[model samples]
Target chain A: MIEFTIWDILRNLLLAARWTVVLSLVSFLGGGIVGALLLFLRIGGNRLSTAFTKYYVEFFQGTPLLMQLFLAFFGLGLFGINVPAWLAAGIALILWTAAFLTEIWRGSVESVVRGQWEASASLGMGYVQQMRYVILPQALTVAIPPTVGFSVQVVKGTALTSIIGFVELSKAGTVVTNATFQPFTVYGLVALIYFALCWPLSKSSQILERKLNVAHRNH
Target chain B: MSLIEITDVRKSFGQTEVLKGIDLDVKPGEVIAVIGKSGSGKSTLLRCINGLETIDGGSISVAGAQLLPDEAHLKALRLKVGMIFQQFNLFPHLTAGGNVILSQTVVKKTPKREAEAMARKMLERVGLAEKFDAYPDELSGGQQQRVAIARALAMQPIALLCDEVTSALDPELVAEVLAVVRELAAEGMTLLMVTHEMKFARDVCSRVVFMHQGRVHEIGRPEEVFARPKTPELRQFLGVQ
Candidate 1:
C-alpha cells in the first residue's frame, strides 16, 4: 500500500477545485447571455418565440439537473454525436442556469410600473425606445441582487456535473477518498470549498437587498 | 381655426362605454377646462386627443393629422401636441433636466447641448431651474408636476393636454401646479385641461366643458357653465342642487 499523506490529498483536490471554478464561471456567464436572450424573446418576440422560451424555462426548471446531465451525456451518444464530458456537462449546466435566470429576471422586468411605459409613449417614444430609455433602466436596478444570488446556485450546480464523468470538486473528492480510505476528511473539505465559494455570493445578495430597501424607503 | 377637432368620438373599455358620441373643437390659444365627476370620461377624452386612447367609432384630427394607428403621422402629431398626466409620470431614474431633454434629443433629433439648454430654460419657466438635477422622487408633488409641465413644454408643441394634472397634489401643492397652468394660459398656449379645481378652471379657462355619463353634457364660457349648469347631472356634479 502506498503511504498517502493528507497534504497530498488536499493538494490534488485543490488542483481539481480549479476545474470547478472554471466550470462555474463558464456556466454562469454563458447562462447570463442565454437568459437575456430568453428574456427579450419572452417580452417582445412573436407568439412562437414567446411560447418556446416559456417551455424552455419550464423544462429545465421542472426536471432534476442530475437527470438532465445524464440525458445530455448519454442521449447525444445515441445519435452518434459523441460529446465529451466537458461539452456535455457545460451544455447541460448552461441550460439549467439560463432557465432559472430568465424567470428571475422576468419578475424584475415586470416590476417596473405600467405608468413608465405610458409616460414614455406619451412623449412620442416608440415601444423599443420606451423600453431602452425608461423601462430597462428601472428593471436593471431591481434585477442586480437576485442575479448575484442566482449565480451562487450556478456554482453549486456545477457539482452535479461530476455525474457526467467530469472531474470537478466532488469527483476529485471521491477519487481522493477511494485512494486514502478517508472519506470524512476528503468530503468535509469538499463541503468547505463549496461554502467558501457560495458564502460571498449570499452575503453580497443580502447587502444588495438591504441597499435596495433603503433606497426605496428614501424615495 | 380648430387645432383639434373631434366628431362623434367614442371609446369603451370592455363592456362599459366611457365616451359615447362626443364632439369637441379646440381652437389655437383657447384654454378649455373639462370638469366633471369621477368616471365622467374627462381623462379618456383628453387621452384620445393625444392618441393615447384610440376611439372606436369616430374621427379626430390634430393639426391636420387624422388619429389612426399609423406610426409616422402619429409621431408627427405627438410632436405637435404635448400631454401632462395627473400622476406626474416624470421618469424617476432621470434628473428633472434629463427628463425634459430626453424626448428632444431622442425623438426630435435636437442636439444634446441645444436640448440641455432648452431643458434648462423650460425648467426655469416652471420655477424648477435650481432642481434641474433633482430626481422626481426627491421633489415634492407640486415640484414634480412642475417638472412634468417642463418636460411637456420642452417639445414646443402647438397645444398642451393636461389630464387632471393637479389632481395628485396636496391642497397647498395644487395652487403651485395651477399657477404654472395659469402662466401657460397667459402666454397664449392652446391648453386642454381636465381638472377638479373649479376656481382654477373658472379663473384660467376660456371655455368650460362639463362631461356626464360619457357625453359632453354642457359646454360654454366658464361663467355660464358654472353658474347655470343646465342639466340636472351638471347641477348635481357642481353640488348646486
Candidate 2:
C-alpha cells in the first residue's frame, strides 16, 4: 500500500489547476480574436466571405469537440507533425470556442433594430462608421451577459482537453487518486476546485444581465 | 430654383409597386407635407429623397448633389438633408448630448469640443437643455423624438424630411414634438413631412401634397387643398367627399 498524504494530493491538484486556468485563458482570448473576425465577416462582409464564415462556423459546431481534439492529437501525427498535448488542446479548443462565439455575437448584432441602421445612414454614416458609432456599441451591451455565460461552458470544456493527455484538473485528480488510493477525497477536492473557478462567472453573468436590462427600462 | 427635384421616381418591393413614376419639386424654405393612405407610398417618397431607399427609376438631385449609384455623391446629399422618423430612432447607448454630437464630430469633422458645444445649443433649441446626460431609454417618447430632432438640426442641413414624426406619440405628447417642428418651420428651414396630423400640416405647411395610388394626386396651398380638394383621391384623403 502507498502512503500518500492528503496535503501532498491537494498541493499536486492545485498545481494542475494552474494549467486549467492558463488553458482556459488562452482559448478564450484566442477564440475572442478569431470570433470577432468571424462576426464581421458573418455580418457585413462580402457575399463570398459571408458564406465562408457560415461554413466555418457550422463545421466546428456540428462536430463533437472531443473528436476534434483527438484529430488534433493523433491526426496531425499521421502527417508527421508531432505536436504536444497542450498545443493540440489549445488549437482544438480555440476553434471550437470561435465557432460558438461567432454565432452568439451575430445574433446580438442582428438584434439591434433596423431603425438604428436607417437613422445612422440618414445621417451620412457609412457601413463601418455606423457599426463603430452605433451598431456595435449597442450590440455589445446585449452581448456581454451571454458572452460571460458562455465563458462557464468554456471553462468546463477545458476539462475535455485532459482526454488528449493535457494534465489539467481532471487529469491531476486521476493521478492523485491513483497515488493516494482515496477516490472520494481526491475527486471531492477536484470538484471543489472547478466550482471555485466557475461559480462566480455564472452568478455574475446573471446579475450583470439583470442590471443592464433594468438600466434600459422605460421611465 | 428647387432645393430638391424628383422626376418620374419609381419604387417597388418585389411584386408591389409602392411609388409609381412620381414627380415633385421642393423649393428653398418651402414647408411641404405629404399626406395619403397607408399604402400610398408617401413614406417611400420621403425615403427616396433622403437616399434611404434607392429609386427604381428617374432622378433625385438635392443641393447640386445627385443620388446616383455613387456612394460619395449620395453621402454628400445625406449630409445636406436631415431626416427624422416617426419612431425617433435616437441612439440608446449615448446620452442626449452624445447623440447630437456624434454626426457633428464624425460626419462633419467638427472638433469634439465644438461639436459638444453645438450639441448643447441644439438640445437647448429643442428645449431639452437640462437632459444632456440622459440616455434615450430614460426619456419619454416626446423627449426622445426631440433629442432626435436635435441630432438632425446639429447637422445644419439644407432641409429636413420628417416621416410621420409624431405618429408614434400619445395624443398628449404629440403636441410637444409638433411644437418643435412648428418652430423649425418658423425659422424657414425647408421642411418636408409625411404626417397624418392634418391640422399641423395646415398650420405649418405652405403647400400640401396629397398622394394616392403611388402618385402626387394633388398639390396646392394648404387652405385650398384641405378646403377644396380637386381630385376624388384628395377629397377622400381629406374625408370631405
Which candidate ranks first by DockQ, i.e. highest?
2
Q: Per-prediction DockQ, in order? A: 0.60, 0.63
What TM-score goes with each of the models? 0.97, 0.97
User: Model 1 lDDT vs. the true structure?
Assistant: 0.90
lDDT of 2 by residue, B1-241 (tens): 9999999999999989999899999999999999999999999999998888988999998988899766688789999999999989999889999999998888889999999999999999999999999989889899999999999999999999999999899989999999999999999999999999999999999999989989888999999999988988777767786
Off by over 4 Å in 1: A216-219
Model 2 is docked with a DockQ of: 0.63
Candidate 2, residue B210: CA error in Å? 1.2
lDDT of 1 by residue, A27-132 (tens): 9999999999999999989999999999999999999999999999999999999899999999999989999999988998898887777778778988788888
Write model 2 residue lDDT over A78-173, tens digit each, in one string: 999998999999999998899888999999999999999999999999888999999999888888999999899899999999898999999999
The stretch of ten residues in a row with the least summed lDDT in candidate 1 chain A is: A210-219
Clashing pairs in 1: none
Ten contiguous residues with the weakest lDDT in model 2 chain A: A210-219
lDDT of 1 by residue, B58-163 (tens): 9988889888877776787788888998888888889999999999988988999999999999999999899998888889999999999999999998899998
